[model samples]
Target: MIRFGVDRLVADPDLLGGAKRVGLVTNDAARMAADPARLARVALREAGVPITRLFGPEHGLNVQSADGVHVDDGIDTMTGLPIISLYGERYCPSPAVMRDLDVVLFDIPNVGARFYTYTWTLYHMMAACTAALVPIIVLDRPNPLGGDLSLAEGPVLDLAVRSFVGEDAIPIRHQLTNGELATLWQREQFAGVRLDVLSCDGWTRAMQWPDLQLPWVPTSPAMPSFESAQLYPGTCLFEATNLSVGRGTDIPFQQIGAPWLDVPAVLSDLARRVPKGVEFSEVTFVTGLAPYAGELCHGIKITVTSASALRPVALGLLLMAAVASTHRLRFQ
Candidate 1:
């Protein structure tokens, strides 16, 4: 089993014992010893270390909901700790939120995709902590896609295109873990945050998450399984179009299409149009939540039989073209 930073922290308290009052920034994915809030807090509490507060990322400390959905403020029902929502109303903690903390800890699992927002949330919170002169610690986990050392696809974001989604010029699937990313951000991306990353032990750059024996938790709504995450770097481009990115389905990003789509034909054309590594399966389903709820929608399931040869953003673009060729698609 891969021992993450949180795992190590629980086993050894001397590392972070120097801090007086600590603040933990996490989400629903934070778990340790069978608890949703995870071991970060429990470890600190067990050591008699003062954990002053809790900060939640996109899905809040209890990970739930679909993409772009916001979480509101409330006490963590499990931990009985005050919680702050960073995904809603604010993207970063105010100086006040960091005022009482000697150190801030971040321990969320991140899929290696650049467009995922947790890394950006790290970027923002680190900046805020920097201004407040608080040191930040990131608990590293494996990049599920297996950190194959390859250059990123898609053009680097033009400064004008920069948003929370496109924070840096890194490629769509920039092959780096949260630890390596934090290092790059401190040494290069962000100017002056005091950053410390606790890296994973027994984890190799080429090992995927399933191979690690750690539990699988969906970091975001659309990204559910290894295959869903595998398809995401490419299929996520569907969001830029009028089609639903499987928002209402049980498996999102895996099956993507709209009621107007000619599902099997599109799959056949997409299979021929893309380079290789991706297999398309025709599927029809209805959304349980979003647009076209209770209505059957035809779409194709994207499967990555081979990660080495698949180009996600390129395939996503081709899929968009296929959808556009048949309908007057607009980004909504």
Candidate 2:
């Protein structure tokens, strides 16, 4: 069993360097893999780390808000720490907020995809900390998609298309963990800020999520299963389209659907082009939430048959092409 950064911090509190005022950036989903019950803040505090404030990236601290929804700043009734909303009114903490903290610890996990916003929050925080001369520590975890650098796919961020999701020019499936990302930026960009990465022990570059032997926590409401995450780097692209990426369904991102979908035509088209390590099966369901909520929809369920053989970014493009060829698709 690999000891994650949080577990290490709990075992050895001295790693914090005796910072008087420490800020923790995390959410409910980022709990310790070993304990699961105690969150990083609670665990760190119990271990004698002076965590003074909290920062929430997208989806809010408790993950109460839906994806892409803006969350407001609030206080944690559990910890009584002032929770600053980085996904809303601001993308980074203000200079005043930075002044109140001696160091900031980012403990969020990435979904092995570049489009997720937590990594970008780190990007923003790195800039803020660099300017304020505050040290930032990233508690690293294994990239859920594994660390096989050869498996990385791209359409590396074109500066023109960079948003909160694609903040840098890395691949859509950039095979780097949060700490590694921070390290890269420190070397290439934010060198002035003191950065430390509490890495996952014994985790190798070739190891995927299943190898971690860690419980799969849903970092976002939509991401409920490992299969969903395997499909995320590809299926999430549907979010920008008229089709529902199972957002309102139990199997979010594991399937794709739109009320107008011609299931037979889609199936026929994909029959010849199914990518390796993934299989498509016809599915019809109602998404009780958005897009065509409550309406019966038709589409294909994506299954990751072999994680090692799948290229999600390429798979995403293939899916888009197949669906678009079958129907007149619209982008959102």
Residue ranges of candidate 2 with Cα displaced over 4 Å: 329-332
C-alpha TM-scores of all predictions: 0.90, 0.96
How do the residues 1-332 of candidate 1 rate in per-residue lDDT, one tens digit apiece? 56778777777766785888888888766566224345556655775656778888886676775567787877977567898888898998888888888898888878777788887888888788878988888877778877777636776668778888878778888878887888887888566778888888888877876687666776766666777787788787777665767876778887786777777666666666765787778888888756667778888877777777777778888887766665554324
Model 2 per-residue lDDT tens digits across residues 139-197: 98888998889999967889897889888899888899999999999999998999999
Model 2's C-alpha root-mean-square deviation from the true structure amounts to 1.4
Q: Which candidate is the best by TM-score?
A: 2
- Cα deviation of 331, candidate 2, in Å: 8.3
Angstrom error of the Cα, residue 263, model 1: value is 2.5
